[model samples]
Target: MGLQNITGLFYPSQTLGGPHIDIEDIITSQNVISRVMHSYLGILVPLGLLAGVICVAILIRNKVKHQTLENLDLHLLALVATDITIVFYSFTSKTRPDYLEVSNLSCGVLSWFFNTSYFFSQYLLVLMILILLILDDSKTSQSHLRYVFLTLTLSIVMSVVNVSLLGTYDNLHNITYCQLDPLNARPEYDFTKFFAGFCVPSLVLLIFVILIIIRAREVEMSEKLQAHGVVLCHVPIMFICRLFYNIMLIRRTGLKINAFYMSPREELVLNIAELAVFSGSCIGLIITLALHKPCRQGLKKSLQFLINKCRGKETSNSVI
Candidate 1:
């Protein structure tokens, strides 16, 4: 019903009162964390956007030349699109200057877009793994588009539910933040999101990764299977990048409900977690380009093409 009621449900002992901490201490810690977060985002967001554009260009060129895309390529393209969307949204939303006003409506909209893209990407990876495991190339190539549509539909629904539980507000210090809106901050929603969004999906992904590994061991790995293996790398990367951020969310929820003072150390950890979350896409893209053979081949071909074109221009200028 409200913050007071939600706090009572989880932290009954602290309901009476929380220990007093100096307001200046809290503000100082917040400011330090904010600077660190902004610095990390400043580096990561632009790098991610640039990498995403290059990857998309490569994929699009391949599609045009071949007149068709493989199932793996389609999935990778979708994943790249979502990752770029997440990075672009972060640039627009999280990196805003402190002096700018952020209305609650804008905050909610940004949060919704970020969460939608993130969840969509995660589930798309899951579907990619499933298709690799269960479907033959012929079947998957024919049906991947339909499956993508289905995953997008599901992601939209899940994101709507996720955003419904959150609301944005400005603190006494005029700092804008998004959190579980007082009216919707129930223990049920908190626990549900923790488990459903993080714990359960993570566990499921782990299981899928294990099964794929086992299957790979059972037979000779072909080029197709090797492509799947490259995609499989994303599962562990996702887990590592997201684990800290989810922990930070759980801790923040507890502190908010109990009205507990967040120490500078905790604030530092929270900023680090936020950094890890944003880094996931960047790291994933790097891994894809480094290990995915087709991407490597594409890069080499593009480089060679550029070199020849530049050489041709030089020859013509010399003749002139």
Candidate 2:
């Protein structure tokens, strides 16, 4: 019998005794790693983002100066600022909970912060590439603005739906910590809402990005300035990293209630996915710096100036 085989197999089903692990163990392991990775970025990426802001400033200095930035550039900067702030507050800052002092309403606020920035950044990037395509006299049926509007509407609805989680906001256990869903939570956490609010739209955006990249390469235009290709390359890699992290978090949840070990291959996949995302951000910076000359020169000058200022400050400190 199948049961006989399982029972009789090699070591036998019976065991002496060992410590049992639950979902908490799994979630804890995953979150510890996730928090560590996020913390690492909290320290390093702010500098990178500052560099990016400087580059953006230089790009617009001749035309608009610091008073204003090109719409795309401004959106990109805002996206970076929000994302960096979220990660820093969520993972790095010792006093991060201070920001939540007013209320526990911030239960998942950081996730929303990152989500909004990520969604906006993606839409803005796509819009930028769309503009590039249009300015080149390319033909298009649906307008970029139309799609942008649609993306916004859908994203807003989805976000609102997700935020409708009807449970007591437990500050200690919320925001970046994995825990069992508050089962009794009302109509908000329904399966339909979960799919509509997150999965479906995300998949749509993912496909749209892929299509843009392919179309960009195929379409004939004056200099073949295909920026969409860069976005295509960027999103998948970022998605992989976040996806890996999510998988680990999910896996840990399952482990909390069950006893099991993941295959070595699965573990490898998760690590590779997470690292790929971190590296993807660096890749994006490089691509932007390379493709946009104004940005590159601006960033270089900013870094040099910052370095000099640091040296000057250190010299003064030593003298004191």
- Using TM-score as the measure, the top candidate is 1
Candidate 2 C-alpha lDDT tens digits along 1-320: 01111111110111211244344444444555456556645654555455555545565573465554444444344434434433343332232111122222443444444444445545555455555545533333234334556655655555555555533353423322111122122334334333453355457666655554565555463244442344444456455555555555455334333445443334334444444444445545545555555566676787799999999999999999
**Reference-based lDDT, each prediction:** 0.66, 0.44
Error of 1 at 301 (Å): 1.5
- Structure candidate 1, residue pairs in collision: none
Clash numbers, per candidate: 0, 3
Error of 1 at 173 (Å): 18
lDDT of 1 by residue, 133-173 (tens): 76457665558888898999888888778766653322212
Off by over 4 Å in 2: 1-19, 22-43, 59-75, 89-104, 125-157, 169-202, 209-230, 249-287, 301-320
Clashes of 2: 3
Question: In terms of TM-score, how similar is model 1 to the real structure?
Answer: 0.80
TM-score of each: 0.80, 0.54
